[model samples]
Each structure stands twice: as structure tokens, then as C-alpha cells.
Target: MFSFAISKSERNALFHRRETMATRMFLNGGVYSMADSGRLDARVEGLTIDPVDGRVLAVGPQCGPVAASDVLQLPAGAVIVPGLHDRHTHWLFALFANAVVLGGVKTLAEAAARIEAQLAEQATGWVVATGWNTGLLPAGLLTQSWLDSIVKGRKAIIFDQSFHGALISSTLAKEIVSKFPREAIGSYHDGVIHEQYVMLAMAWMELDDWTLKAALLQRQIIMGRVGFTRITDMGVMGFPLLHALQDIYRRGLMILPCDFAVQPWMLREDPLLSATSASVLHFQLRWLKEFADGAFGNRLACMCGHHRYSDGQGGKLLLDERRYVDDVLLARERGIDQFAIHCIGCAACEAASTAFGTVMQRLNGESSGCTFSFEHFETVHPKLIEHVARLQRAHVRIEVCSQPGFLSDLTDYTDRLAAHVMARINPYGDFRKEGLAWRAGTDGAITGDDPWGGMALAVNRGGEQTITVPEIMGTFIDAPLAVNGPATFLILDRDPFAHLEQLGQVQVLETWIEGRMVFHRRN
Candidate 1:
């Protein structure tokens, strides 16, 4: 097997500098800039950007000197807003050409058709897909044999929407079972693997650089189309994915900024590249990622009482409480300043928080300069919320990288989770009421990477959890879109505030990263 290697010349080429220019661009529009105290600003008629470096020159009441030749007026219906930042995403597979998405399949016949079509494309090789929503079909209907029947001669694996488990066909099972640990037997189904085994399943598919290139090509088109300017990749599994991205960035193909996670699994496969920190100009390995527990759809998000997935045995923690505490210190040793732990269940959340507290206790009030981000913080028992707040006081910098898209998974939380557990599902309002740090992400594992689609979920969620359009938009933009910030933003076709109910219909006319226009909707 060929390893990903970069020569001295190639490494130097990654940072070749260019002279900066003073070219400027001016836009005349009714802009909703985060500049005015982060409140949905009054109609700002002028916006200026230094096109050379893509930094905002001026906007709203702070409009500075402008040249008449620079003004570019948008169409009458255009609505300008700050570019979206997705806090969590698996960038590699978001648009992988071969990785078919089953998020829309509503029936077994539909799923079968998709698998067969993908198999037909290749005479031999595995057909990998993800985003298999459990609500689409009866859970009993999807099994290894059921998947095998879809494409008899080919190897196949369809990962569940939750990204915590999967159903593998027999042919692929033979390839994955040998190394599969016997003690880690799965509980979801006959041939289904859950928790860390999902990583093991993906490891079976050794994607080459060529396969990855096809997927990398979709990064700009797909991400910009969905209105994202900066994406924080949750973590990528294999070496080829990161290497493929590095190659693209080397060739000046990267269109936007991304903070890629340096996952623990990558240390064994690509330690040199993983430790380098800066992979390319716009992509950096800034966050170290790990899983704390399984997810909701798998009936495995460690609950307290009898929920749908458990009777009394609340789900699972990927590691014991002691292991998590050790890992926190290990993260500090690795020089990882940012840590993202995946936790969905209340018990899982508690375990992760306690581990952070343990490390702080050992520090005795010394700051390690490391921040902790909890991914998929969908549930937390009311009592544990205060403990989390106290941990923050003790200097375990905490933030929730939440996926609002998961709200679509459950129609009525009361019907699925226990009475006590259901109320806490994505309790954003509670987080706000208690002053918790939180941000939005389109997980892409279970949902598509559409900021508007995710925002629509929050807007329509009406009740304590429902957030005003501007407040939810803040989660995507990071802060007020003030001067000197990156000239990355979007042109929506209509006013968002006026049509909050129709957010799903809002169209992105253009997406600009820096001063460059990356995506323009075809007329």
C-alpha cells in the first residue's frame, strides 16, 4: 500500500507567498450585518470589501471612503447576510461521488434501487452509503441479509442515519469480521456494529487517492451551495481523505477555510501529517476529536430510565469514566488546544463533564489553555446542567457543537424517549436560560449540510426551544459581521426575517469566500 508522502519541495510549495494588492469591491444592498451589536441591523445600504485579501472594508453606518467605480449593486430582491460556519461536519464523505446518500430513501424498494444503481457503476468493489434514517422503514426490515439481497454479487454497507451503527452485507462482513473483537459484540441487530466499530467498518474500505479526488472536487460546489464559508470538520477517519485535501490545497483548489479535527485514530495511520498542525493554507488540524457515547437513533444515547432503546440499562459510554479523565490529560500532552467529544445521552454528557472536572481538580485551578467542545449535545438531565455550569467555572472551557438537524429525527420526543428524557432533547432554550456555550452544526452524518434547512428546524420548532431567526443566525455566523472580518457572506433571494416560516424556500443566490465568489445560482 502506498502511503501519503510529501517531499521537502512539496511542503515548501504549500506556503508560497504572493504580493498583496489594494483592489476594492463595493456592494449596495440592504444588508443584515452582525456589526451593529449582533442585532439584526437596520438596512445598511453600502458594503465595501478589499478584494485582494477578502476582508470587509466597511459596512452599515461605518462605511468608509469608497470609489465610484467599485460599487456593485445587487438585484432588487437580494438579501445579504454573513457566511455560515458549520461547527461539525465530516468533509470527506459530504459529497463523495461513490458514497451514495440514503437520507431520502423512504422505502426498502427505494433503498434497494439506490444500492443496485451504485453497484452497477462498478463491476467489483464495495458500495458504501450513509444517512439511512431509521424512521423511514421498520428497523426489523434492515439486516445484513436484507442488504445483501439488494446487490447480490457486490460488497455493501449502509450506515444508519445516526452514524453510530451500520448493516453490512455478507461479502463485506467476511472482510470486516476477522479483525472484529469478539467481546465488542453488537446489540443493535444480528449483523449490525455500533459505537467504535463504526470506525472499524469505515477502515475496511481503504479509499485510494483517486477515489478521494473525485470527492474533494465537490467541496467548494457543495459547501458554497449550502451557504457555508467556513466548516469545522468533526474529524476524518482515514489518511487518504486528509492527504487528498492537502493535494488539492497544494494545487490552489481550496475555496474556503476549514478547521479539520486531528482525530485519535489518525495518529496510528498518519502521525507525521496529523501532528503538523497546518495541513495547508486554509485547512488546519486544530481540534482533537473523540467519541464519548453512541447516538439517539441507535437507541443507544445513554439514558437514565426506560427509554425506547433501553429498559433500565441506559446506553453506553465509549470509555469508562476513568479512561475519559486520562484522555483529557493525554490531549493536553499532545498539544491539542481544542478537544471535541461526541456526547448525546445525559449520562454520557455527565461522564465527559466529570472527566474534564477531574483534570481541572488535578490542576487545582490552573488553566491548561485547552477548550472542550461537546458534539451532539442533544440531551442532558436537568440536574446535570448545574454540574456542567460549575465545571465551566473551574476552567474546563466548554462549548456545545450542536446539530439542530437532528431535531428532524424525532417527530414527537415524548413518544420515543422517556418522559423525563424527552424534554431535554436539544434544549437550546435551557442552555440559553442557564448561560451555556453553544453553536450550530449540520452534522451531515445524519442530515444534509444545509444551513437554511437546519435553521428551518429551529424556526419551526416553536416553544421554549424555538429561537428567533436572528438569534439562530448568530449561531451560524459566529459573531457580528463587523469590519476587518473575512469578506465571506451570502446573498439570499429574499428577506429572512419577513419569511421565517418559509426559511426552507430561501435560496442562496451567491456565496462569497473572502472576495471571491465561489457559488452563483444559475438563472
Candidate 2:
């Protein structure tokens, strides 16, 4: 539950305190606090329609009109909309290794130059660097010999741009391999581990809890200042980590609003554990993410034509149908509401759809209430789009991780690598026409967190579909208020990115979540 303090009036007192907890406030004058009760009330402007109670309350001019309230007026020119719901973000991983950015380095020498600088600045015994794309590297693939020479004797690890693969020094690799079982050791090929193997290997390294905590808090605050009121933390691995973060925010050290989407493995370990609570109030914990295939950069996404590009060798499937079905059924049995399957390629999407349909039948009605979401529909086939539409009609949601940066980030000399040819068949407009609740997200860290970037990429046609920015944002604006907002909300046509301009020119504008002013754009 979320609580807040407000300026109120009592018995002629100008700024009296309302200590008693209250649920709803319809005050005719002054301010009030509901932090103790964990309820919040805020008035948002710049709306085309009134979105008060999950319904379109009003549209046209009436929607944007000021409501009758005794709370302090927010002053004019401050455009407000419903807080952003970033459905996909690698928040933890990004902050953990953000300063060690390694994008845009062309050659091994350039990469070494950057790593050498990072090592000098880093105070820790262990140094980790991320965000180097092997596909875009000037010298092609980064061999272990190349990484060894750069770090010399330091315990260093360089993660590929995909974050799924890494080039580790032999010293660090040897240190990590000791904790894992025998079978997992095969990931090391000349001390370079790719995909899940890299994550497992890095987990073995020592991490200072105190230092990590401070860094995350500082990063979260910075994001909040950037107008991010709500973020979905997909990086949280377990209940403890989620609990720790929640506690930090409850102490009023909030930088941004957040909703945690725990990984599937965490839910499997503790089925009854509810990561949701009063202090960590506004949360959606039902999403269980599973990877059907790895990333495209690594050529590990399960696809029918993966072999065509990689020496006539197809990609590997990360999650088999049996494991997929088991996880889906388990979430269903526990009354969990959703599962987001990271399916990128056509084959993976079809495989995931089948697993969901199978689980739907197995769970009967009690467990079928949970929705299934297919994340990153990058290389989807035309025929599969029809099946996906059917799933949406049956309450399934699709999250298209549209990042235009990928075009520049993963260019393969020609525009026909994996999804280049199939781009025309992505069918984004088709899904919209079919009336599916489609949402866009930047896999953040991997792609920058500019919502406009995702919008521009998705709209500026490829394959067979061409959508405009107005059309995409139009659908996006309506879906969240319809599906996630409180009783009576508002949808604004004003672009959030553009609204930042109003800050210095006019008032010291801000936005409040559950009544707490979490963001105040400075002049």
C-alpha cells in the first residue's frame, strides 16, 4: 500500500494535518494525506478523454477540463498524462554495467582502449564490462586471446552487446567454473561463454551488496527525473531482491515508480510467495517470463531458417515445449495472471502459441484466467499473426520489442540477415486492425529507453506493414488506461517527450503517482 501527506484545513487552520487514514477524497478545499492508508488521488490534464475508472469517462474538451478539487492547482501549461508503463526493461543489469558501455567500438584496439580506461577508474577487485556487439566488431569475433591481452592480469569480463554472450579472462573463468556442476562447464570455449552460460558464470563472481544497493538507488532516481513514473523491472530474479528494492522506495527515497515482473524460475521455486504488499503497493507480479530462443545477434533464436545464415546451421531452442507447458500450467494452477514468453522468430512464436493453447486446455477454467504474452515478435510470419490475433481475442497480450536502433546496431552489410526479408511480414498493422492490445517496449540497456524511438521504428514500415506515429501512440495511449488505469482516467495526445520543453519556459511542472510527487521537471 502507498501512503502520502497533503496540506489540509481544519477549524480555521490553514495547513492542518489529516492523520487519520482515508480511502477516497472528494475535498472541496485544501490538501490531504493518505500515505498512512496507502491511497492516492491526482488530477492529470492534457487528456482527450476522461479515463477515471477503467472506462472512457468523457472525450473532447470536457476530458481535459479541470475537476472540482480543493488541492493546490497545478498551474497552467503543465501537460499531464497517465504515467508510463515500461513493460520490458533489464533495469538491474543495465545499471549494474551501464558505466562500462562498449557500443560503437570498431576494432579490438578500440575495445581494449575503452576497457583499459574503465579498469583504471574502477575500484573493485573484479571489473565487468558489457555492450560490445560481436556482429558489428571491426575484427569480427572477439577471441579469448584478444581479451587476455587487453586486461593483462586483472579479473576482467567483457559481455557482448546481446548481454547473452561474453569474453572472459581465463583467471575469472576458472574462478566461476568451480561452483557449477560438470555439465555446465561446456559453455567455455577458450574462455568465451555465450548466452545463459555467461550469466551463470558471472553469478559466481563476488558482489559487494552495499555498493550495488547505492548504485541502483541512484540510477532509479535518475530515471524518475527523466519522466519515467512507472517501470517494469524484469531483471529481479527472486523475492529477496524484490523485497529489498521495495523497502528502499518505501523510505521515501523514490526516484521512479515501478512494477516488478519476476522471472519464471523464481516463481517456480516459491509458488505461494506474493511479492506484492502494502509498502510495495502498486505491483503486477503475475508475469512469468521464459525464453523460447536466445537473441538474434548470437543467432540462437529458434527459427526455421537460422541455419541459412550461420554456415547452414539452425539456431538452438532455449525452452522445449514440455518445460514451457509445465511452467505455464504451474503459473495457471497458482492463479498467476500472465506469462511473457520471449519468442522472436517465427518458429519460436508458433511453438509458444501451441504451448499456451495446450496449457489452456489442461488447466481447465480455474487456471486459464492468466493471460499469455509473446515478447519481441521480431521475425514473425504472416500466418502466425492470424493465430496470435486469435490468442489476443481470447485474452492474450503481445509485447513487440520494437527498437529501430537494431537496424543500425546489427547491420549485416545487407538488409537480409534474419528478419530483413521477413520484415514485411511482421504484420503490426494487421494486429491493430484485428483489435489486439499491443504494447511497445525497448529491451532498454540493449536499446535506449526512448519510447519515441520504439514508436518511430514500429511505424516506419518494413516487410508488409506501415504504421504512423499518431496511429501507434493512439493505440498505446488507449490500451493502458483501458487495461491498467484506475476508475476514470485520461488519455492525452501530447507527446511526453515534447512536454519537457514546457518546464523551463513555464512552471516547475511535475507528476505524482498515488499522490506523491515523484517527478518534478526543473526549470
Candidate 3:
């Protein structure tokens, strides 16, 4: 196989540089050094990088260089910025992209036909499909009978676009119902599965270690090309995934640095405290993830009021409030300093805030440098925002990890929401004004993990709440580019601020991680 390798001169120059040496120069580019003052200092035209370890050596208009091969000169019109960070995503889902995708199918008939075709091609134990949008399908359209007609006694599981719900063939449904109880399965007749049952059914369709490792490696490469040097895998399962990641890193196949937030249930089951001590470079077990409610699109988000088109009743909560508080306290006691709670609605947000407030009060406002995050704070009601502000006033150190891509992905559904509810969606400017620390994420593979695409959605979704380019960039790149920081950044084909509306279309010309070029656009 043909391989792309750096020239001999380049390799020699890079290897010969001392740890304290400034031997590499990146010149003639609009360099965005994300300084601590929240200012966009883009006037710099050059940067000195320590070739030995890939850290920024100095930032200015000019830098000392030893050899031409050691210097990377930017092309005309190209701009360099800090590498993007996705605050929340399911790494497993991204790895499972090989599963039959049904993202754009408009109706139930289209979904069924696609599933039928997929199953016909595979002689399988169980067929798994994903990305069905129940919002587009008519009520009562996806039932056990409907799935049975397609699967024809074969076992199959089809997940909704939100991944919160699922439709299974009668064969699989009967098997699940028999193992558990009919009522425990949520709704056998409608073929709808939710909560823990979704995890249970998915566990049955297991992939071997090699398959998972390949999938993860492929996904990481794709993310690198899109300009992500680091990501936070929101809720990873157990040791298998971690073991796979360790194996990949050992084989020198790792691309991006990942921090895993183990699910609360998994932490409770094993508490894998030793896993944190395990020297898995590029991997950190950062947070304990808990779900407060379902997603907004499925009308299952724990809301203060009924969904506009639905049964005129608010959604249900996935985790009890008291239990959530207990979980937070327990996680802290176990030395897990951070928590990422999924809250997409007013009620869920309020519940999370209350739980966080209780934990803070008990700890006497000391978190030991730990942070609490409300993931997917999608529906930003003014009252909920106020509630959060009050918590911040008490030194709660709460952060909101939101998905700006929701504007682009769920446009139609959000448009049809109650006028009052729709008005509060993604209150980015409001969060900023209220002095709330916030960041943006893609929540892939539900949405495209394109950081620039997400930035465009945040920009074009016109409201006083819309975020500025600098502000959006701040969400991805938290700290300044300095000598000690990771040598991770991207070179874009065009300045993102210069082409705000076309941000999504702007190509990533080059991606660098730890001072090594991981991806370069082919001429």
C-alpha cells in the first residue's frame, strides 16, 4: 500500500530539534491565538512551534527557523485557528455509522422499504437500523404489525432519529417481552421501546472487539479531517470500549484525544476507579453522565407545558430528581468531579438546577475545581435561564453544553412548536448576557459533527440570541495557544468570520494535532 510520509529532510529536522528549541515556523497566515481576554488577536502572521513536542513556542509577525523543510508556509487566503472541540457526542454511535442509515427518509413507508431492502441483502442474526424520524411519520403508523410485515418473522430493531425510541419486529418484541415483562418493554403493540430497554435490546446485537476498534479508528480519522482534534464522548458503556481505545493507542493508530463520560448506571455497577489509574494515554474518564429527560424532537423532552401538536400533556422525566441529587453526591464522593446531565426542556433544566443547587449547598459551595454541566440545554426558557443565573450567583460553576446544529437539523419541528416555546430555543445571546459559561456540541451521529456547520447555524439563526464568530470559536477553543498547550489547530481554506454564511462550505485545508499534520487537503 502506498503511504504518505514526510520528506527525509523534514523528518530529520523535526527529530533533531531539542525540547526547548523553536525550530519550526508557521508563517504568513491569519493566526487566531485564543488569548485569555476573550479577544480575537488575529493580527499575528506567524507562529514558532517546538518541533520536538509540538507546542507553540512564540506568536508574532516573524519567527526564527532553522530549515525550509521545518517551516509550514500558509497559502494565500488560508487562515489558521485553534482546533475545534465537540463538548458532547456519542462516540459509539459515530463508530456505528456502518449500520443502515435512514436519516432523510420522509415517511414510514420509505423507512420500511429501506429496511426491507437492507435485510434482504444481509443474511443476519438481527438487523439493526437507525435514523427514523417519528415526527414525520403519522401517529400510530409505526407498530409491531408494521415492522412484522417488513421483517417477515426475522428479528430486527429500528431506532428513531432521536435514538430515545425504537420500533422492533414482533419476533424480537416477543423475545424481549418474554425475558422481561410486556409492560416493562414500554409498548409491545406499538413496537415502541424506551429508556433502559433500548440499551438492553441493543446489547444483544454485539460487535466483536476488532470490528469496534476499526469503526472507532475510522470515525476518529473522519473527525480529524473535519478539524476536531479532541472530543468528549458523552456516555461510553464499559471496559470493552476503553480496552479497544487502549489497544488502538498501543498500536499507534489513535488520531484524536478523547475524554469519556461513563453512564451513571455503569459507574454504579462497577465504579471502575482503577480504570482511571490505568495509563491509557489520550483517554480520560472525565465525567459521570446522567439523563434528566428525553430529546426535544420526539415530544419526549421533560417540558413545563404540553407539546403543541401532541396529546396536550407535558413529557415525562427519565431520572427522578431526588435520585439525581443522590447520584451527584455519590459521584463526587467517588472522586468523579464532573457530571454531564442531559436536560433539553424547561422542567428538565429546572430539575437539574435544583439537584445541582442541593449538591452545592451540601458541599458548602466547594467543588474542588470540578464543574457541573447541563448537556443539551436546547429549550432556553427565560425562567429557566433565570434559575440557572441564580445558581451561578451562589458560585455553582454550572456550564451549558448546547447543540447549535439543532437549528439546522430540527428546523421544521421547532417551527411548529408552541410560539412561546419556539421563542426560547437556543438562547445563546441570553446565556452570554446572563454570565453563563456555555459551549457548543454536535451530538453526533444524530447531527453532522461539522464544527463550521454548527457555527453557521448559530450565526444564521437570527435572534438577539445568535452568537458571534469569536464567541462560537471560544466554545470550541477554551484556552490560549501557548508553549505548554497542545499543538492542536486547523488551517481553513477561508477565514470563517469573512464568510459567515458560507462557514459550513469552508473546507479544512489542514489539520494538526500535537504538531503533526494529521490531514491535508489534496490539491
Error of 1 at 59 (Å): 1.6
> TM-scores across all candidates?
0.85, 0.72, 0.86
Give per-residue CA lDDT, model 1, range 1-523, as digits (tens): 5444546454323322222354677788878887664467456766788878878888753356656666677888787888888888877563346777787677888888887788777675678888676655545777778887777857777776565677778887777777755534234446676656766666557565655664565655677777888888888665656667777776666656888786555553444544355467887777877766644233436321112344333434555656555655555565566777788777667666766666567656554677777787877766666656665666558777788787776652334566566556778787667666668998764567787877888878878877778767878884445688888788889888778778877888887777777677771
Model 3 — TM-score against the truth? Answer: 0.86
Candidate 2 lands at a TM-score of 0.72
> Measured by C-alpha RMSD in angstroms, how accurate is candidate 1?
5.1
Over 4 Å off, model 2: 1-78, 94-98, 138-141, 178-186, 201-205, 238-243, 250-252, 255-257, 267-279, 294-316, 329-335, 395-422, 425-427, 460-464, 475-509
lDDT tens readout by residue for model 2, 266-350:
5555656544431254444656676655443324242211112332222334556666677666655555567676666666666
Clashing pairs in 1: 34-480
RMSD (CA, Å), each prediction: 5.1, 8.4, 5.1
Residue 344 CA error for candidate 2 (Å)?
A: 1.2
